[model samples]
Target chain A: MAEDTNSKEYWRWTESNWRDPDIDWKAGEIISVGIDVGSVSSQAVILVDGKLYAYSNMRTGSDSPKSAENAMDWALEGTGMTQDDIHYVVGTGYGRVNVPFAKRAITEIACHARGANFMYGPTIKTVLDMGGQDCKAIRVDQKGKVVAFLMNDKCAAGTGRGMEVFANLLGIHITEVGEMSLRVEEEPPMVSSTCVVFAKSEASGLLREGWPKEKVLAAYCLAMAHRVVDLLERLGVEEDFAITGGIGKNVGVVSRIEKELGIKALKPTLDTQIAGALGGALFARALEQKGRKSK
Target chain B: MKANYGYKDGSGEFFITLDTDRCTACGDCVEACPYGVLEVVDDPVDPLSDVQVAVVTEAERKKIKYTCGPCKPVVDRPPLPCMTACPEDVIAHSW
Candidate 1:
């Protein structure tokens, strides 16, 4: 491959979508919103009468409330729907409690399962949500209620941040890491370090020993895939399995995980990263209906 | 609304106390806890009652400071999952 000079443009994925142009929000009676403020990214989703209307995914800033507001604003940019136009709002993820306008806050684990149920259909029994700084393996019943779950956020070894470090070192865009790593003709030896700090130094040492960047990336991705597999096994893998969060977009990790488990994950037609926020929106809709029934 | 148990060490403070008066032993915390830090056992802290109650697991009793280390939120983050899952308004962490 020829060396590319555009260093600035390649670090992030371009697959993010702001809104679904097909939906006409004016025709719907109820407009519910869900905002997920995660450690690395934030998402805002709008549901019009139980159908997805608009959504936005962006990097989370320092302030949780501000991140929530910015994401929601971006999703509503061209929709002409202000905050007050939405009937109810549900907040989720690590910063859920800090969402200023939310009526209630739900855990990311619950929201991810619910969103996977909607996005992947009700058959999804297991969900692996690989977020920026943490990972969660969740088991959900047919109704999408969380039956069992496990989370690992203390370490960056199997998380998105770990991948970002490799991207930065290789000077390739984070979006390109997956494809570039997959381009290697042969699978390289796995990096032995499980800690992010140690792994970075390990990658540097490999490069010094004349290993190509692609091979190094392949090693790191392989280590990540193995680490996540252990977490999934602890919770017990049940089918139909689906993966959520930004890492779901990486074929390098997803395909390896499937190969190791001998079970393919259910593919989502919509963006997998929005699962948490989408689930929160669905919860908002349900809450509105429940309130009406009680009244 | 909250109960605390444990002690402070050179590394940090570690405590996992349950309010026996408010605990109903619903097992929600046990289900939500990912670290196996909690379990349903006979009420040893509260002798007045015969009901089963949630307590720190024997394995975690001496090592809670290390076991809960991974999920320990910074001062800014939300409450822990197990504490948040409890409907009876009990369960807390000190760190």
Candidate 2:
């Protein structure tokens, strides 16, 4: 992190701003793969030279490692690339070591910090990685270096799986419930229970109460969003707070949080869920560049 | 009866090797580790043995028990559970 200058120009042209100058890898320039095997979903992000050309997000399935492999295959398939062109492979998230073929494994925190730094600039000091099993608050420096972090690893109360659970009960696709939430006409039933099991019971009671699907969806969204907001507050969440992981795509959740916190959260155009994979890809480039400079 | 069953390696480390590839990530190992150093990661369908992947199990002793005789024995290959009941399917060597 001390490797950078503390000047205004330095901040403008920060490490976060550095992209592989040769955006297009020469036909055979080595490609690096970052496979994030999360609990609820997995993704594969590939960087050829410096430009990100391929990313795929899929249900993580039942296994972290195999799911990571499947996600990688999907991404490679999308870009008309194959395993052979992948010069190096990295595995992160809960399944970092599960990619039997990966050359190295890294922590999810490191990957998210790097990715957020790249997309939002070095000034991004905080991140909310709301994956399947956990929600984490990460603080980083200008170099995309992690400074402090906290995670809610033991609970699924505010994660993708939490929503998936109720979505299953409602017989609705988890993807569509976000949009359905916007149609809510009333305050919806209040969900005060923090335990998912308790929440499930509460939802069951609401169902019996004849709460319409619209209001029920609204309640679910609020309960879930509140849990996330609580976690963010714990990490001393600051300006330029970015949201990543698969749940980041839920505009209902995103808008609610933005309104609740009175601060806008930043998101890049790529699949927000694949941010961890993208961060893993960006770190690979940094490692290679540093290796070159040392020689 | 506590007894020495095998030799240590170049690293002077001894462990009962389980064929992780052949072994399903059923999380039985997590329940069995007497030292409590294992936890099943979420989405256990295909478990990676390595990430926040693993942590020191907190049990009576927080460290991994290396030479709990009658249990794990080093070998040219790996070992399976004996007749001892671990309650957690953790390895045991009492015979």
Candidate 3:
């Protein structure tokens, strides 16, 4: 019984990886991969003949195919690439069928609308995601497919494991909970319980009435951006919009869900938790370009 | 105002709850839902109280734990045809 290592896991979160040093994956002729595995993190990506050559983002441990092969061996670590030079993999979220080196699995709502149409483009047409035990909202279309969606994974009150259990109950450091919930001094009203166990006992009863853990992380990121704007108002927020998971690196719940849906979500120069493993490596490069145009 | 609906991932809690003031848009739990997963609508939580209720079906509200897993029978379990066709008990599943 010896494993305390000075216990400081304030909801961990900080495993990373990247690659693209002007691309060269053995003169790529397709490569493609995309793991995902999500039930609280695990990405992978890698693309090549379709661009973004590497990625990682770790954490989903209790073994989902060894967290999708440790997020594809940390996105092919030194980049001398392996997994047999990958030609097509795919496997999407919620442990996408336990990704045992998937060749196809898909559905993380059509891989977060084709990974928010390749990381916020294709005019986005709304996405949202916010994963780690669920919260979807999709809509897509202009090629990213899924024209309608709205998930919630029932409870953990607005996902990302309810803001990593409210940043390990305010010991704080899940990447400083969005700038310490925007160093609050005024916003405090929400947290009326959307139910992450009753908004974490109403944020420890407002820190026992004295408040301040940045005002209970600004009333629990304004009740998780008003419960993800009531699940993106049941699929009706169209214009552009994009948000992809890992709570879109929480700018206190994406600036209060862009001030309650006045839009403005589309900003991601890559790594908004690798939009479902970059839409499962762009659906494993469109299923290896439809098996080389049906050979 | 017990709305609930479904979702509680990593395999557990598949809510359904209704009791929206004893829901009475009574489509008999949308005809004892055999996976159409109930319907009726309108009461987006008291939209100025016009009252239409029943709910759950926004595409089976995120796959109600696999569309209410075929009447949830594991042994003798027998109360679900949408909570025995809810007559004001206002449905309830929470499995």
Candidate 4:
């Protein structure tokens, strides 16, 4: 079984699931769900009374609704809970409206801000969510309300999809890019082109010229870091910085960003990719509270 | 220089185009936008041009129809606040 699974897999990052094993869902008064269907990945998060309960992250399929449902189902599995148990559902990310079960659709900007605020605490004022197809630099208030934000969906250069292409080209697993690139003794010059197509061709040329794979990866990661920092600077960065999305797990880029901005990112104990869905779940809880009070 | 906002997905395409040449980069559209969708950025589409122009924020680009849904026209309503605020008359929406 293990050999078969390994043989079938491509250069894909491992999908992940996490649950607060100690949390008793039966005792929780509120159960809310947040599903974020991104272009490259989908995440489903379950919250019990404003606390993280469970979450699942998987590659997004072509059909966003199917991806959303599958992610939620994976998260719900073995939890002894079903869709009926969820009191409020907030769908977010690229396919927010496509979430059939979501009671409301929230923008990833607001959701990421709320998630960063919760994960990094009230001091978090800046959130950089680098997702599959876009990068967002959001400034939020102490309570996780959006102050000002900017997003870059116009190009794939600085997004996860770009990184995925590079990973595939380099024949490296997506998860290994960060650590592997760090192994380079000296940082390489950044690839000039921000367009993925041009960058891919540039990488091929570098490989043919005998540049090591690690150096090429470093160059791309540096370019990505610089590009995202430009986005953050455009919106204006503040202290108490934090990053979310799949790229947040990649220290190669994150460290470079921290160095560029001169502010250490507020690290999250849990997986950073779940931040959006987690924020959505938290919003659902807030809505749940309002509903209860109004009733 | 035309910059299109929004993306093509399995469902369909939603785009909001801004002709930068007509825009004066005045803060009118930015201030008039209640949803905070428009911002003035150094024109990225035309690198040779240093002129800053109002364009849809990146996050709102791919989802403007949904993001700006609240202000969408209903039965011959007046122009949108952003469009109305634009002195240059450069904004157009593809619904």
Measured against the true chain A, the candidates' chain A TM-scores are 0.94, 0.85, 0.39, 0.95
Higher-ranked by DockQ: 2 or 3? 3
**TM-score, structure 3 vs. true:** 0.35
lDDT of 4 by residue, A63-127 (tens): 99999999998999889999998999999998999999998787787688888888899998888
Q: Which lDDT value does model 2 have at A140?
A: 79
Q: How accurate locally is residue A246 in candidate 2, as Cα lDDT from 0 to 100?
A: 56
Sorting all predicted structures by TM-score, with the top scorer first, yields: 4, 1, 2, 3
TM-score of each: 0.77, 0.68, 0.35, 0.77
Q: For candidate 2, give the lDDT of residue A239.
A: 86
Error of 1 at A199 (Å): 1.1
Q: Write the per-residue lDDT of candidate 1 for residues B1-95, one digit (tens) a residue.
A: 12233333224345675765587889999999888888887653222235776877756655677788777755667668888999986775655
> Which DockQ value does candidate 4 get?
0.07
Best by lDDT: 4
Q: Which ten residues in a row have the lowest lDDT in candidate 3 chain A?
A: A1-10
Off by over 4 Å in 1: A1-11, B1-95
Query: Model 2 over residues A144-229: C-alpha lDDT tens digits?
Result: 76665555555567777777777777877666677888787665655777777888888888889998776777887887777677
**lDDT winner, 1 or 4:** 4
Task: For model 1, name the residue pairs that clash.
Answer: A10-A173, A11-A173, A11-A174, B5-B16, B5-B17
Tens-digit per-residue lDDT, B1-95, candidate 4: 44555643323345676776688888798899889999998764322235787878866776676788888866676678988888888887766
Give the CA lDDT, 0 to 100, for residue B51 in model 3.
62
lDDT (0-100) at residue A251 of candidate 1? 85
User: How many steric clashes between backbone atoms does each model show?
Assistant: 5, 8, 3, 3
Q: Highest DockQ: give the candidate number.
A: 3
- Worst lDDT run of 10 residues, candidate 2 chain A, spans A9-18
Q: What is the Cα-based lDDT of residue A278 in candidate 2?
A: 79
Alpha carbon deviation, residue B35, candidate 4 (Å): 18
